[model samples]
Target: MADLLTPGLILAAAATFLFAGLVKGVTGMGLPTFAMAVLGSLVSPAAAAALLIVPSFVTNLWQLLAGPAFAGLARRLWPMMAGIVAGTFAGASLLASGDTGASTAALGATLVAYAAWSLLGRQPRAPARLERWASPIVGLATGLVTGATGVFVVPAVPYLQALDLEKDDLVQALGLSFTVSTLALAGALAVRGAYQVGDLAVSTFAVLPALAGMWLGQEIRRRVSPAAFRRWFLVGLLLLGAEMLLRPLF
Candidate 1:
């Protein structure tokens, strides 16, 4: 923790969170993915995961409550959420084992895949009949990925989109899922002894900048084309992913 708080690192973290929040604001997701991508490159994936807990939980909680369809979404998504917790707990040690190189490469690969999928703008729909069986499987896969990389946007986000939910319901659904993932990830990190007093303090401080960035992003969204912004964002993420993937090899 002491080593991570060097003035340069602190500044880098603040900037990273701010940019992450900006993406989340525009796309209604990407906070964790962007943070993990950038911070995992700067620090270990385990350390970056710890730092994102507070901001991610707080913002996603707000998103969860801001809508009127909480009851229905909760009822529909409980199994998947449960699977997330179970899977995260089951794979909790993947990131905690002090294998930074492997985790960083995993994180890079995830970002690259997700960014490519989003760039293609292909929104595959899951039929209503399949939800009964598909949800838990998706949740488990998502949790395993989250456990390993601290990024929960892979199959989970795509699965959520495939539900063909109404726009607002989809957004609220994402909030619910992310909130659960954050809580589960936090527990996993704690079990692995990644959360220390100094780390918690820095993480807490990051929340403010994240919120501010989100606010700014919302304002920007009102004026700019979200689709355009998202396209560019994915491009940058793809490049970042390439760098992360190649980093250890050199």
Candidate 2:
């Protein structure tokens, strides 16, 4: 635990969380994805996962509850949430077994894959008719990935984005999904003894910088187009993913 508190690591953590909050503040998503990628660069993937708990939970919860659409969104998205819960438990088992290198590598590859999709892939629309079957399927897949790699993107983010929701609803949906993923992940870490009181305390402290960033980012969002920010964000994800993928090679 003491090892995680070194000045360099603390600085790294603060900077990473702040950036994560900013991205989420502006785009309504990407907090965990960005934070984990950057933190995974400086720390073990497992540690990065632990560090994410508090900020992810609080920020996402705020996102989830701040809007008036929670009930409607929950009813519409319950199937996916259910799948996410089940998949997370299954994925966490693998993480708890100490498969650090493979998990982190997988996380990196997953990020790269998603970034590629965001950058170059066509935005496939979710047909209104097929949403019933598709929602849970996407949720399950996302949960599995979250459990295995501590990431909650992939098909989920793109899937939700494709729904063509109102901007506020879309943001709430992201918050809802992220909140579920974070809690499910916390459960997994707890079961495996990877998460502890001390870690929670530290993660809680980390939330301050993240929130500060979010506040600043919200101000920025008022001025900049999200489309532009997302383009650059995807490019960054690509580079980070490549690094993670190739780290074990060299």
Worst ten in a row by lDDT for model 1: 1-10
Positional deviation of residue 89's Cα in model 1 after best superposition, in angstroms:
1.5
All models: lDDT? 0.88, 0.88
TM-score of every candidate: 0.97, 0.95
Best by TM-score: 1
For model 2, how does the per-residue alpha-carbon lDDT over 106-146 read when each residue is reduced to its tens digit? 88998999999989998788988999999989998998888
Q: Candidate 1: which stretches are off by over 4 Å?
A: none
Candidate 1 local lDDT, 91-172, one digit each (tens): 6687888899888888899999999999986789999999998999999988998898898887899999999998999999
Which portions of model 2 show Cα errors greater than 4 Å?
Answer: 1-3
